[model samples]
Target: MTQFEALPYRHVLTVPTVPTAVRLARETTEDVLTELGVNPRHPTVGPALLILSELVTNAVRHAAAASPQTTVIYAAGEDCLAFGVHDRHPYQPSLYGAATVTEGGAGGLATVMELTLGLGGTAVVRGDADGKGKSIWITLPF
Candidate 1:
């Protein structure tokens, strides 16, 4: 019998706030999913990529503006993968409802929410480390 070592919830990554980071995030996430038997051509891939893009963009734009030294990390647990974007800004992200979703404002947040919901997942935004910054996290069930 072979023993499988249990994984921890601390697979963290800190990437720069540049265009390459965005590409790297999408590619790395796709690779992770594929390595876990998730087909890249699956319908869910589109929305997943879109969510990743929006979150990363926000990090590079808003978060980076407030805190230039931010890094996005991914922590994988037993049944889910959490995508976290941590910035140095000491503020929380707000979620928009259906009205904003249709109003064409707050599009990135809305898109992330919609994609996460459609994929049977949830999106979370909270202040990081004593509320010195924010981390926008989305948990996707595997």
Candidate 2:
């Protein structure tokens, strides 16, 4: 007989605040989910990927101005998967109406919120303990 591991698998990745960091985060997330036995075609995977992209992109574009690196943490429980991005920017992301979105910029944070809600998940934004940075997290149920 084969033994199975317990729930709440966790992984943490740190990357430089560069454009390529988004792709790295996504790839690493996919690998971690696979190791956790999450199906690639599962409904949650797509939204999770998008969420990771948006958060990492935000970190690279905005938070990178404050710090040159950021960290991504992934936790998979029995019925949910949570992802968090930690950056050195204490400012919370701004939410804007759809009509105010420009062509090449804006709307990323809004999209993250919408997709998280659509997945029956919660999105949280808060400053880190030392008051020197911020962390954004989203939890989605499988």
Candidate 3:
């Protein structure tokens, strides 16, 4: 089997549900991509970082009430890089319309979906079977 078809490289990190988690996630993502032979400056890397930031920030803002810990999973394969943020909030993310000027910025999930689609990737939301948490994942083709 080709290397690409073999098992993917995976890393998981548990972080406090705080704003600073976004920065930590981004830095860890860069390190993982580099270790996997994916260039840190690759086109997909920027969007991946942004997606990580948005998802982690959303978890901190929306789910910290349920639990103060969030888990980030990163997986890298020959053709794709995937990241998932698992949070204690049971509610799935709501994708609203484009952010208005008064909203102060683009909606997090909306931006994530847009970036993933633009990169010919996929975005998914999965809720835990126990209904205690949810995970948001984005997979981008490299």
List of clashing residue pairs for candidate 1: 89-133
Task: Report how far residue 28 has shifted in candidate 3, in Å.
Answer: 0.5
List model 2 lDDT by residue over 2-107, tens digit each. Answer: 0112335879999999999999999999999999899999999998999899989988988888979989988778788888899998887643242254688648
TM-scores for all predictions: 0.77, 0.86, 0.87
- Give the range of the ten consecutive residues with the poorest summed lDDT in model 1: 1-10
Misplaced by over 4 Å in model 3 are: 1-7, 95-105
Q: Lowest lDDT 10-mer window, candidate 3? A: 94-103
lDDT (C-alpha) at residue 66 in model 1: 69
Candidate that beats the other on TM-score, 1 or 3, i.e. the better one: 3
lDDT of 3 by residue, 1-142 (tens): 1222243788999999988888898899888888899877789988888988988988988999896999998877778888789998888865433222235666777787778778888777779999999887777888
- Give the alpha-carbon lDDT of every model: 0.69, 0.82, 0.81
Q: Model 1: residues >4 Å from true position, as ranges?
A: 1-10, 77-79, 96-99
- Candidate 2 regions exceeding 4 Å error are 1-7, 94-106
Preferred candidate (lDDT higher): 1 or 2 = 2
- lDDT for 39 in candidate 1 is 69
Residue-level lDDT for 113 in candidate 1: 87
